[model samples]
Target: MSLTEILSNFHISETTEEIYKNTIKASEIETPIGKLIAVADDNFLYILIKLKSPDKVINTFNILQKELSSSIVIGSTKIITQLENELTEYFSGKLKSFTIPMRCLGTDFRQQSWNQLKKIAYGETMSYGELAVKLGRNVNHARAVGSAAGANPIIILVPCHRLTAQNGHLGGFSCGIDVKTWLLQHESKFKNK
Candidate 1:
């Protein structure tokens, strides 16, 4: 049977063979800003993408379906639930840092950049050059660091929104510049309270 057929059973087998199967559970949750589609596996939360309209959520799911060889089932796990709660608190301005478990998928260099991205405190912003220097990379490595930041898949949970241009201009965000501006403004408004 196909992986999709297996996932349609709605119960994941814990056997060794089943464990080797890359079964991804996905679900969509609404937020104040918009709807976010979360895709995760049994042990780790994978990618979370934001959309301005509910209609576009499926487009992302379709893309993931093609990109990942795993079974992209429409379901949620305990970890996904927890992350959703954390997102709720964050968007509501009650949480600063996320406490949920996440296993980031990226290269060592990109991972280093993402780790530094998380270190940026809430209500604060840093430039790409500053982030690169903090990671012990040369100042000119800022552009490369920016590339890694753009590649980050976890989005708001990792606080990629905290990164700005050296002159403090809002930088690029995969979710769009408006969303970036909103996230920065949202954090700044509640970070001091």
Candidate 2:
């Protein structure tokens, strides 16, 4: 179904002085990758995210749809939409990681890192040191690269959880390490499928 159709199914009512206040509709679509959450407001696509949220997953989509109904189409991807669905199910404790197409905006280097992050495959991880080397940079650049990873606007769909410290410690996450740990364990448990 279309995004509008999905959003129309929700009961939305709220007002925010924040920029997201002008939204029109929002929706969540399930995909092989994860749950794709999209917000459309004032003719603009405000936020599209993929992640697991026990309480906010469904609510966020409804809220966003009613907030940004007018704005620019920030980005679009059938893969992302599909991923959203998968993630929603997973977050609801029904599934695991996802495989889907996703799009993001950032600097050249940040974009590169984000793209590489997507390839990190579920249940596996790469130390910042290893990531720096894969990016063809000296291991010393690991910290800098880690910073870039943290700045990633799109979180889970980018799979930033696959990155960690050299000692296999969960480092930092833009969305919170608790979420990261959950994702890692979830993926690891169902990775082979």
Candidate 3:
């Protein structure tokens, strides 16, 4: 379906901001699994995942959407809705990995790095050196690979937090190290589950 149709179905509104033109939409629904809040941006969708109760998670997609311009288009699928559910659960100390399909715009190498990041299992971490090796590059190329990973616009969906320094030190994150820590901790909590 078209982005407008999807947004309309969910009762979402489109608007423009100083930085970008974007669309924001969300829905609260009762499901067999539980209650869920689904949020979508122009390029990505997020689900508010919960652990014990859905009350804890706030629907931030609209806030983000309102901040952007309306020129952006939202992708179609239930994936963003599911992701919102899973992310809600994750932040509340419940979920680990997400199953959402994400579309990232980037160059060939950046795309490769982002794809490699998805290979990182939940609760597992890999150093930039390791990622570079996986790409068949010298260890010194780790920095470049990390740069590519940092440029990943999809963040959690691509699992960039899974990449670290060789000594296991937390490195730079485009979204900030605190977010990276949260993602790591959240994933670690679900390691065995």
Candidate 4:
């Protein structure tokens, strides 16, 4: 399917932001959970979705799509292939870190927040308040951190699923709490190995 069609299929609205028509490459690969949709430029993998539902996919795509000025083609690149391989290893519990080149788009704080999310170790989690303090923000910024976490485009590679509530509650995950729970459990299996 075409990029626009794919977006529409997921119930994403046509964005008012400039749509880049020819430079984006995307691919759909089936995974243990469901289909994963990935998009990338020549040098950076920009979007990766675990495909829980249209809402999360649309939210993530909209954030990354705004910066691209070309149409998204369904094909694989060296970067895409590497990402697929890494994801395979990850789901199989053999990979602990992702080495694929990636880029994120968002405001400065949001970008900083996503970058910090990448530092959360597999099978470990921290409250949003802890993340805010880690980011050098006062505790009040926890909500802002949560917002940025919600907007993370790179999903598992960046590990936004590792952020939780101060009381140890799984706050909210763009994909769904069940997926978040599964990811944490999956990572925990390999944590002490």
Best by TM-score: 4
lDDT of 1 by residue, 1-193 (tens): 2223433543334563353456678777787666676878757777776744333344444444445545577788887889888888888899998887776767899889888888999989999999999999888998998899877768887878888889878878877888888888898899898
Best by lDDT: 4
C-alpha root-mean-square deviation, each candidate: 6.1, 8.4, 9.4, 3.5
Model 4 worst lDDT run, 10 consecutive residues: 10-19
Task: Score residue 98 of candidate 2 by CA lDDT.
Answer: 52
Candidate 3 lDDT over 1-193, as tens digits, reads 3223444443433333344534445545443334434445534554332212222232233333444433223443456656657766766656665766555556788878888898998788999989988888888999999889766655566778789999879988765677678778766777787
lDDT string, candidate 4, 1-193, tens digits: 3344665564323663234445677788777756778888779998887665666666666556556655555688889899889999999999999999988878999889988899999889999999999999998898999999987778899899999899889999887888888899999998877
How well does candidate 2 score on lDDT at residue 145? 79
The lDDT of model 1 is 0.75
Model 4: number of clashes?
Answer: 8
Candidate 2 lDDT over 131-171, as tens digits, reads: 88888888898887798887664566567888999987999
Worst 10 residues of 1 by lDDT: 1-10
